[model samples]
Target: MPKSLKSRGGEEELQCGPVFTVFAMGTRMTFVTEEEGINVFLNSKHVNFELAVQKPVYCTASVPKNIFFTLHEKLYITMKGKMGPFNIHQFTGKLIDELHEQLGNLGSHGIMDLNILVRDLLYPATVNTVFNKGLIPTDKGELQEFYQHFETYDEGFEYGSQMPEWLLRNWSKSKKWLLEVLEKNITHIKAYKSEKDNSVTIMQAVQDVIEMEKSELIPNYALLMLWASLSNAVPIAFWTLAFVLSHPDIHRAIKEDIASVFGSAGKDKMKVTEDELKKLPLTKWCVLEAIRLRAPGVLARKVVKAVNIMNFTIPPGDLLMVSPFWLHRNPKYFPEPELFKPERWRKANLEKHAFLDGFIGFGGGKFQCPGRWFALLEIEICLILMLYKYDCYLLDPLPKQSDLHLVGVPKPEGQCRIEYRKRI
Candidate 1:
């Protein structure tokens, strides 16, 4: 399914102006391009999220129909409570520890793979923040072993949904291992009490459901949650750092922002608070720019009632889609559409003006991601840690945003390396 989506890479749709239609997997998909139509597509009472994602999820994510409906409800509620802006600062301590530990291994200077560096650092840090540190082995060698299977699982996720599992032995093995790990994590969480403070993590938030065994589908639920949450966010972090570090002026600006908020690194271990994060509008703009530039190529829904959008009627049951990748590129909303310009955001009124209309890093209206706050906060801190601790820039040619994404921001493609030296 991801391969099919990648095949065209929005080129065919770009020719169709605001809207077009295509048939895939026995479904008619209406792709909405302009912000006006996108606004309608996202908010129409007739258009919905669950029905739109059910099939692909069942196929690739191993979630069956009976449990799918209830599982998402549970997740959505938990996500709102755990990942929302109200208490976003809670996750920073674990994230700081994890990022510091990973980045510390650089030992002052080295060259590294852009993809591998981000993947290894983000995955366990994410896992620990989302679940618990003990959920996966913390030692470097053992953690890498676990992440290897997760890598395979993540890499093959799209194909795994459509193709037979038997054909992809490696992804199959990795999927099994991931399920077992999640199941064990669930069991362990249910049996144990926190030795530390009583701040609720998502795993603990869902303990009632897992403990009662109301659904035997707990493992698959955990796996899907992991993928959906991390898939876009981790790559957004990669792009944010890539764009900032490669541009010396932006890099310097980001560093200055960090200096004002957290003081200089190396004097003592740098600590960040949520209030301090708000001070760095430049850093936030840079991060938002990466998300805008590398935003997901598509989002989808199923129209349940006939709806009129852009002088045309979209019939019920047709799969409706929108391309933020193209909407963000609309020159009226964003001048010089192809360039990475963080400064543009500063000139515009983000709330009252049309800028927010074009910003679809999270989805629109009712379809907006519940994890939006968590994802943004996570990226900000990761960027802060990187700039605070290292002097880094690209060594090889800069990587282009890969068309290889299944959802959210695509990963960086092409061969690229970084020359980074520890600052502290």
Candidate 2:
């Protein structure tokens, strides 16, 4: 047996699989790959997991500041009340308009980098949807600066986790910039009261919490929420479009599905509502399958007490890691997991297959991503309009997955190019 597969008891116990451990930057971490072991850890009550507080294996051993954790907890609570499917659907419509305007500027036909297109459309649209344009920076340079800071902070999580305390102290520049942006936005909203006439945005909701609790951490919470809303969205959108266009059958079926639901496509803008989008099963399935294939990241938890899972005894104070990227491809749940088969998600087949239980692309249990439903709505709307209004194809073959970062969404090894021509 290979050394990688040998368990703590050696090759004789390879059937149990090895529980790999690595020491990085003075922090000890455990990596689990078996399906049963991960499921047990994720669903276990003894395992404690807090997204903002947990010291992810990739980051320094120091715990996040108390204020940061408080901000996250409060924001999560506030989002439960403010972010609903209805609100997300309404935001999706506005997002469609913004994307339409931007795409129009690109002309009728040309080769474009898929990553750039996805970022350009999502960044501003997400800001508007979450905070309203009145609160965000109006200056293009400031906006660009903010975006660069965010990317820097996000990319740093991979290496920062392995750095010591002295290096970690220097990592606050990105956090400071993000907080400054949020503070300015909050001050603007308070002074102008612009959110009074319009629907309550996430910014306004966080402001309310700040007022009620009299906590200074609200601005940081707002910044965290903004990051959460923007981070994984672009990658998910890119993969969804890439996979749909890569497969001839899937692409044709999606276009036909859009035509059936929205009528014959033409020069006029395609107005698709959330209700209408729900009717396109194949389109939704294609997006789900894409996520299962390309979305790679791990769920980290710290054991608060000694726990026994899958006949292995795990000690208290150990870091536990589970990767959905591996779980989603498990042969026990998904047959021929490498293939892109949207039909596997059909209603009748889904009922018979227990694969749904194995699908943890969005995490699981109480720790499940709060923005999941909204994320799906946003992706579906983008895919629907792009397919309906334009004819698009891959200009470059799908690149291998790279940058499997510990904190953020994974990206293609290199740029995936695509060509688009407006359909009239």
State every prediction's TM-score relative to the real structure: 0.90, 0.85
Query: Which 10 consecutive positions of candidate 2 have the poorest summed lDDT?
Result: 1-10
User: Which stretches of model 2 miss by more than 4 angstroms?
Assistant: 1-18, 55-65, 68-74, 85-87, 134-143, 161-172, 189-198, 347-355
lDDT, each prediction:
0.74, 0.68
lDDT of 1 by residue, 1-424 (tens): 0112222243432234456688976779888766667777767788888998887688666777766786667667767777766766777776777777777666788888876777767777787777766777868788878878877887787777667889999998998888888887886655554456777666667655544544567777778777876677777887888888778888898898788777767843566776787687677677788888888777888899987777878899988888777677777888897777898878756333234547877877664687777777777877888888888888876676667654557767776788778776
Error of 2 at 2 (Å): 6.5
- The clash numbers for all candidates, in the given order, read 1, 3
Q: Residue 16 of model 1: what lDDT?
A: 48
With a 3 Å backbone cut-off (N, CA, C), the pairs that clash in candidate 1 are 60-161
RMSD of each: 3.7, 4.8
Q: Write the per-residue lDDT of candidate 2 for residues 240-347, one digit (tens) a residue.
A: 888888889889988998888888768465677767876887876877788777655677777777777666677777777776776777778788988888787774
